[model samples]
Target: MYIGLLSYSLAAIFFLVLLGVLLTDRRQDKPSRKYLLLATSISILWAGMAAFQSGKIELLFIYQTLEVLRNLFWQQFLLLVLGRSICAEDQSPIIYRAKILLYIISALMVVLIIDRHLLQFIPVLAHYIDPLLVGYLVQAVAVLVLLEQMLRNTRKDMVWAVKFFCLGLGGIYAYDFYLYSEAMLFQHVDNMLWQSRGLINALMVPVIGVAISRHPEWSSGIFLSRRVVFHTTTLLGGGIYLLVIGFGGYYVRNFGGGWGVIAQTLFMFGAIIILALILFSETLRAKLRVLINKHFFHYKYDYRDEWLRFIYVLSSFDETIPLPTRSIQAIAQIIESPGGMLWMKRDNNIYLPVARWHMAAVYDSENADTDFIKFMEEHDWVINLDEFEWNPGVYRSRGFFSLPDWLRSMQNAWLVMPLILQDKMLGFVVLTHAKNRRHNFNWEDTDLLKIACRQAASYLAQHEAAQALSEVRRFDDFNRLSTYMVHDLKNMIAQLSLIVSNAAKHKNNPLFVDDVVSTVENSVTKMNRLLSNLKDDVRGSEDKEDIDICCLIRREVDNRKRAGNTPNIELICVDEKIISTANHDRLASVISHIIQNAQDATPVSGNITIKLHKHINHAIIEIEDTGCGMDESFISTRLFRPFETTKGKSGMGIGVFEAREFLQRLGGDIEVESEMGKGTLFRLHLPLSRVK
Candidate 1:
């Protein structure tokens, strides 16, 4: 049997089988199913006639009649499937009239094909008109109607379900239209098209089979998976490969002398081996899948699964695992990267490799002054290294140099995602080449990466803040302990001063000497007590009492006068006792600290004056010294800061701080007014004791 005949015979058998199934299956007796059944039956008959009666004039008329009837049935089937009203009364007037006109044209063609003698009545019509050509034209119109219906009514979501149906039926009539139109124009059919027509029709049956299987009624039992498309594509590719091999073999066999047959056979076998190798390559398959999914699929990712997996990785929170490592792994897994390194920002415009997952070859640190860092910081770009290497112009346009040698030296670096927070470049992470290297990064990849970077940067920023806060807390605790120790030392110094004052008078007599020794021993014991209190973590306690503020000021002035070398110290106060509610020891320590500071600052000739007076409900004490005073900047910025002082090695700088804190505790405050190289005034405000 001829190849064309055999192909048509096989197609007829398939369609007949399909028709029988549709008829016998009582469930598929709906109007749409019946219309489809009728169209398929017509197609089967047409194929059979074309296969067996290619040259018979009588059968040619039958073939043409079947073509017109097939066109009409298929057109009606499409109209019904698209939910268009087939009944003339139910349709709009214009649609009804158009359908009637189409029916009239089909009927006239059928009549012309049936009665050849009718053509003799009009010589001009006979000369120009051919029944075979008229059949193709009518079929072409029917194909156009189906196309219009498909395009107009098919929704995007339903395209996959009805895709095969459109391709199958559309392919059959479209090819017929082309074949017959060419035949009419050239006066005969093209041999190649005529021979392959049966094969083309047979191929469409499988596609139509897919459409029927996907139909709502039949979809449950016969379902198409992604594997079906993959296998179909593979089969089509294999067919093309074989066709190429056949052409190559024919060329070699005809051109070569005696070795032609042998050469052709060897060439075909080698080609087959090469084609098999190419088809089975995993890398090529991955690349092809990526290309198809990127361009063909509506969604790039299965967001539900991707989101769940991403959250799982981020929330893992294993203590043994560093956060940066976990962060890099979480982002890298999204793109299926093999490994990556995380660089965190360090001081001095540097980024250091803080954590890595499976990538050991990256440098320990990189300077942020590099062009790459500058570009990423300015644009907040997620750099694709492969694209950078290939298209340096993209980066160059943005004022970037080629990929740095340091980065290129790291063999697997594929992407650099910047960790930016609040317009600051925290650092960046460099992902190694993905397991599927052929998949290029798109906007989806960049968007996901940037979001992940933000999350990671937040984690890093929080961790750094927590560390700084902890250090500040430690310093606060240390300062508190030191303040208590310093207050204890001041008490010890006061005890020593009393002993020193009586030493001269008591030195000559035994009894007085004994009393002097006892006082010295008491002072030593008190000094030991202060040291012991410091060791035991004793905090300063407030013991508030109604104390004579004038008496306290007089006693401090007298003590300073006795200890002074030449600086004149004078006290001016009213005789009426001015009492204040205060912690006696703490208030005394504060007043003493201020007086000592003034005396130390004053020259031998400078006079220090202590004046006390009552103002409303408070007692005001002014200690004025003709001393070298402080500038405004020093007084404003550092005067009360602990351990900040101009006394170099001699002063601890905590005196003003301690004094200010103590005075505030006693419901009082201190104010200073001073100028460089002139005089300093210290004013103390203390709440008066209500007992009066």
Candidate 2:
């Protein structure tokens, strides 16, 4: 008996539909249509084989030849399906070799038929045809393996399509296996069962068609569309219903043994699922979308799992440890973007792509044009998706189009966000798509993109700040070096001052040995004090030591008197050996410097007094002189800084600065009470621990 005319007609219509789709899409060089061509061509051959199953000898020969050709293309078709669906790599060599072998085998098979030689592989028995037995087992196994490989080899983002494609093939294979087994074992296969298999196979064409056609061209519009949700709900609901009913029937035949109660229970469950699906179609569609978004397309989310993960990474950062390249790649993977690169502004004119994650080669165009630089200068953050026409808010937006060669490419067009710390822009992050044309970024993706950008920005800002601190530290070292050189020079000047003083005293009295000895002795004392001061200024100390206030004052005043023509000096110490807690060498140097200033300011007979007073917490030594005093403006601004002194010829300007610093190290302070043209009083407040 011929297969029912209706099955043949429906199969013919499906074949024509697939053929038309293939021809139209293939004209446009669309790769998606190849799947349709293979499925349709195999189906048409199956229909023809079914039609001519019980015909005459001559007609049987023709139909059998067609079956051989069908088998040949079936193998080729499986290779194409797996290659396209799996790695996205073209492996047409498999098909080419299969076709060549098929031609040689077919010619041999034709000669066997004519000469009555053995071709025992044929399933047609003498009594009745085995009804798809020869074709079903081989094709089913081949296609099943192909689908399995496709599911296994594809990337995670494309795995859903691979899974659906496998399931579709599996569904068809199940039906084919059932009918083929029944025909071989029971010697009869139900027409209804075979027809159901064909219809199921037809359903898969649309599914697999959608998988190949719609995939790899993802748009925000498609994901956000209501129709996509509606279709998904309908398809998934129908699939579950069929799955339940099919498995339920199978269970009744096997485990249930066709039990009435088991059948009824299974039927009820299927009906309930179907009824609920129909009743709440709109709600179910919306629910399906929510499920998909929650599970897969959550990259564009504001408060998604991706957002939380990104924030968690940002918050738990170790600034000392470097960020991994995989971290940036994870951002791109999460968002389904083509590539991403993190950029930081190193200085005014240069931006560097420090970290990169991409499937393709990343472009590193260091020097952007003046306008591009100016754009970054003007705004802390920027994003250009090649569709910069949409950004009406950007002034001089034409600069985006004027980027360097590699940057002008769509791969470099990015969504950039500036990382700011303390209202200052530190760096920018960029996400781009040039290789994979699918732009999976949505509004939710943009939100997550911002989150990724923010996380990257924070890390980059920290790194840049650390780098700045390193530079400042180097500058400080250089400044300290300059200070050391000047300190050594001051020691040499002190020694030279002594030599000049001694020489001046003995200039007219060569035989006055007494005068020479006293003068030389005073010079040696001054030199010892100056050398000690020089050592204390260069290498600092924190220890508190004993200080002789009267002795230190007398030594400093004598040095001033010997060096200059002024001579009215008196030392009035309440404690002749007043000791205090201080770095004694540093304190003595400060005392001497203060006295020299007083002596310089004193007139020809002006009084210079060094008075020491001991308080409960500190010992105060006041050096008063009738000489020029300091103004409030000069004292406040220039007192502690270098190159800030009143005396023109005698001062190196760092004396007061170094003196104040020395006193501070000893846990003490220096205070000044002065009037312009009147003598200045320098008071040293030394901590009591420095007393000896």
Candidate 3:
């Protein structure tokens, strides 16, 4: 295959692609682009004609004509650009000169072509080395002249828009000058140079495309995809980088003849050097990302990315960073703030620094009624301190005056962001200045920061809520512990009351004296254990020790017997040994409580039956009382209620509630059944321990 044909084919394809861009580009009503489109079309035709003109002497004229038209169209396009640029508003006579230049070019086309074809017999024209080739020489000089004037006359500030264009188009015309000058001097075209021209022109297409992009007047601002800009930029930069690295490695491996090891070492070190700079110098990368976001996008930040990152930072499993500090960090990253302090309102109604991220500890706090606090609550806007310092009148004046000494005195105070939760100002974060970026603060930044702060506010709120709940649980545990203590005391007092009431009657009974000693010892042991539990101050620790269920019931029955013989006690247990894992003191107190209630409910003549047996891995204790019975409604609804009791003033009504709860904690539960004018039965189910 012919090399020129292949090169021209590729050039034609490149020009066609450019033509598509022009056709599809949303032009901002620039009539100049239409000339560009025409010029591009002429390039395609010019290259295509050259590609097909293989040794065809007749088609040579058409190809040469196409070249002239392509040049003329390109020059015409430049005239239109000048009309909009340097020569715009009657600054120059480029339009009129372009008409005169076109006439001169038309005269050359006629004189050159006709002389070579029809009037070659004339010695004067023949002696002058190829009139057609001279015409081509003149066209290249004219293009160079126009390019020079365009570059020189363009305003200094507007030079960038024309520079790339001039370089691209000038390279083409300059190559033409070189090619035609050599042909005229030697009287024949250089075949190799002519073959390479198509490839050279194709390379300049990208440069021209970039030039068009630089001049925004070439297209309208219909839409610009940020993702396209970012990815395209990344790909271009990466391509350039890989090309450089590939060339460097080629040089290292091939050119280092005797120093192979040394060359390899140097190459490795070069990579390390680049890695070191990338690892240590973050300012460049940060600035680059910021620059791309600030310039290319319609918005300052990618909200979706920011939101995901914010949530991840807040909910990360890394516990070394507490919730409050993570809250500060999440907000700080949005604005590229280096450090921050989170001020949260404490229980004392004072705003204090709950956490600080990359900042010094803060000891200052503000009363809730302070003007700053009130201002933050009323007006929920992200306060830019620098903006406030510049224009104090725009902000609420009261808040500015009430700012603390530490805050006002700080050197790099940047912004104060309010963490607003459901319309309430939960807290505010103080963000410091971004490290080396002189970023222009705008409403977009504020809006994004506000949303992020609100999200962070919820996280901090949940954290605070969890803390409050935990504190409440601690107090609740203490209150329940106190209630259990009081209930235990009530049982102990009943035992003492029984002893006091029976001391006179049993004073002469030796066996009764031993029973009195045993009762006192049991009460003393319970008091000591209560003291130990109070000292420990820990609650909610279930299952302290294994209890012999059989012995426990019998003792509880005997203790209730000593309380008063109001109701005669009966014990029935088939099992000799039934072990249960439970708190010894609590289980005993609960059993005693149930028995005391049964005794109080029964008449002096009525009997209380305590029946215990193992049924399906559970030690079921049935306490039935033959006395004034309860209705089914009371047993169902109010029997085990925390504070409902028949003996209103004398009873602490949490006994049954506590009893049922304690039983459930030990893999056991209580069931109550009763009817009006009938006896009530209390059935307790305790899961029998695996141990004998």
Candidate with the greatest TM-score versus the true structure: 1
TM-score of 3: 0.39
Residue pairs with colliding backbones in model 1 are none
Question: Which has the better TM-score: candidate 1, or candidate 2?
Answer: 1
Give the per-residue lDDT of model 1 (tens digit) for 268-376: 9999999899899765765666564443333456667887887788768786665677888888988999889878775556786667788864434578888778888
Rate residue 572 of model 2 by lDDT.
85
Total clashing pairs for each candidate: 0, 13, 0
- Which runs of model 1 end up more than 4 angstroms from their true locations? 13-34, 54-58, 81-92, 159-164, 188-192, 208-220, 224-236, 252-269, 285-692
Candidate that would win on lDDT: 3
**At residue 1, what lDDT does model 3 achieve?**
27
Structural similarity to truth (TM-score) of each candidate? 0.43, 0.41, 0.39
Q: Which segments of model 3 are wrong by more than 4 Å? A: 1-6, 25-30, 54-58, 84-94, 110-115, 118-128, 151-160, 182-187, 214-217, 221-692
Q: Whole-model Cα lDDT per candidate? A: 0.75, 0.59, 0.76
From the highest lDDT down, the ranking of the candidates is 3, 1, 2
